[model samples]
Target: MCTSSVCNHTPKPFALHKSSSVEEYLEKNKQWSQSITNETPNLFSDYNSKGQQPHTLFIGCGDSRYNESIFNVKPGEIFGLQTVGNNLNLNDETIISTLEFTVLVLGIEKIAIVGHTDCGAVNACFDDSVYETLPKNLKNYLKPVYENIKKIKDVHKDDIPPIDKKQLSLENVKEQAKKLLSVDFIKEKFENNTLQILPMIYNVENGLVETIDL
Candidate 1:
C-alpha cells in the first residue's frame, strides 16, 4: 500500500497551549483589568499616581502555589522577592539590591522571611541522587538551601520526615531573617527599631502560616 495520494493525513496544529501560552496570559490580564477597574474605578489610577510604597519586603519561596492573594496582600502592599527554598544570600545582587532599594530608598519597615511546606527545593536536600542530575546553574542556585539543611541536620540528625521538614523550614526562616541583620544597613535600621523581621512558615496542606515565636 505504497500510496503517494497526499497521505490524507491531518497534521496536528502548532500552538502554544497551557501555561506556555503568553496570549492566554494577556487575554486573562485584559479581562481581569476590565473587571477590577469596573469594581474599583480609581484603583489603577491611584497606583499610577502614588507609585509603590510597600510596607514589607516579603522574602518567599519561588513555588507557584503561593502568591499575594495567598497572603491576603493587596496590590502594591508587599515588595516580594521569591527565591528557590526562599534562600537569601548577600551575594545575590538581586536580593541585596532589592533590600537596599526597599529599606534604604523606600523606607520599608518590615521584613518577612517565609518558608513553605513540601517545598521541592527543600526536599531535594535529602535526595542524594538529585545533586548531580540538576543543571549546573540550578544546582549552584540550590547550594544555600542544601547548606542550611546540612547545618540543621548536623545539630538535629535524629529528627525524621515531617518533623525534620518542619524544623528545617522554621529554622530556615529564622536563619535567613538573622542573615539580614548581618547587613550593615539592615543592622543599623534594626538596632534603631526602624526595621522588624517576621519569620513564618506557610503550611501548604493547611493553607495557614505558623509564625516563629522569635
Candidate 2:
C-alpha cells in the first residue's frame, strides 16, 4: 500500500508589536538561538562534549523571573537546587539527596544560598494570620522561617511590623545556609575548610546581589 500526505503552508511577514519586556526577551532569544545554530555551532559544542563541572552549589527561590544566567555566571560552573519558596527542606528526602550528591559526589567547594525581595512565600507567611489556612506540607515547609521569625525577641514590636517581612527573608536565607552546614557531608567539608557556604539577597530594585552577613 502506498499513501501520500501533502501539506499546504502559508507564510506571513514579521510585524513588530508593543509588548512586555518578557515577550521581547523571548523573541530576542528565538532570533539569537537560530543565529547561533546557523553561524556559531561551537557556542554549545563544549557543553555537549564536556558536561557540568558545577563546583558551586546554588540554592535559590523557584521564581520563574529569577534566571541564573542573568548573573553573567557561566553554565557548568554551578550546581543548582531550586525549590518553591526557597525553603530548605532538611526533612525532604530529595533535598537531602541532592545536598549529599552536590557535596560528596560533585565535591562542590562552595554553596551559595540566595533569597530575594518581594517573595510571595515570605509575604504569605507574614500575613498567615488572615488566611489561617494552608496545606500541612506547606505549613511544615515554612515552619523553620516562621519559628525563626518568632524568636527574634530583640526586634521591637514597632520595628517588627514593617521589617518583619524583609528581616525574615534575610534570616531565612541565613538559617538555610546554616541548615545546609548541618548535613554530615557538608559539616565535615565546612569544618575542614574544604567547603564554604555563603548567603546573599538579590535586590529586586537595583538587580544587585548583596552578600548577606550571617
Candidate 3:
C-alpha cells in the first residue's frame, strides 16, 4: 500500500513524515561520517580545515542514473560539473569562470567529459523529424548539441546518409572532448602534462563505461 502523497493510493502519510525515519537517516549519516573520520582523521580534519582538494573534474549529463558516486573512485577525488547537456559553452562567462577556478584554484589534475547512451538531449538533436516544442532557454542550451550534429552531418554528407542517432551520440561525446580542449585552462594543462582530459560514454542498458580516446 502506497501512503505518500505522491503515491497513487494512500490513506496515511508517508513513513518519513509519520515515523522517525528522517531522524534515523540523519543518525545513520552521522554514524557513517564518524566512521570516515575515525578511519582518516587527518584527511577529514584537513579537508574540513583546508577545504576540498578534489583533483578530478567530471562533466556529465543531468541524467539521474549517471550517479557520480558510483564511479568507484575515492571520496574527495572528483569535482563534478553536471548539466542538462555535457557540452561546454565557449562564450558562457560562468562556465569559463568555473573552469579557471577548478584549474588555478582547485588544482584539478583530470578533466573528464562523460556522455551516456540514449541521452534525451542527444536524441533530440539527432531526431529532426520530431517536433516537440521546447522552451526558449532549453532551445538555446541545446544549441551546442545541435551544432555538433551539424558538424558531423556536414563532414559525412556525401558518405553517410544522415547520421544515426545512436552513432551520433557516441560521436557527440568525442566531439565534446575536442571542444573541451579548446578551453584555455584545459589547453594549458594539456601542454604542461598537469592534466589528462578524457571523454567517456556509459552504456545505460549494460551498465558499462567505455572510454573514448580523443
User: What are the lDDT figures for the candidates, one per model?
Assistant: 0.78, 0.72, 0.73
TM-score between candidate 1 and the true structure: 0.80
- Model 2: how far is 92 from its true place, Å? 1.3
**Once superposed on the true structure, which residue ranges of model 3 sit more than 4 Å away at CA?**
1-49, 131-162
Candidate that would win on lDDT: 1
Give the per-residue lDDT digits (tens) of candidate 3, residues 1-214: 6666567654454323445677787987788788777877776666756677887888888787785665876567788887765767767786777788888899988887888888877776655554245455755556655655657645655664556765666677787778778877788789899989878887888888888867
Candidate 2 clashing pairs, residues 3+ apart or interchain: none
Residue 19 C-alpha lDDT in model 3? 58
| Per-model TM-score on C-alpha atoms | 0.80, 0.71, 0.72
- List candidate 2 stretches off by more than 4 Å: 1-43, 131-162
Ten contiguous residues minimizing lDDT sum, candidate 1: 10-19
Which of the two candidates, 1 or 3, achieves a greater lDDT against the reference? 1
Q: Write the per-residue lDDT of candidate 2 for residues 1-214, one digit (tens) a residue.
A: 3253432343323333355477787887788677766765765676735666677888888875474654666546777888765777797888998898888887889888888888766766666563346555745556554545444423434662565667767877887888887788888888999998888887776788888897
Candidate 2 lDDT: 0.72
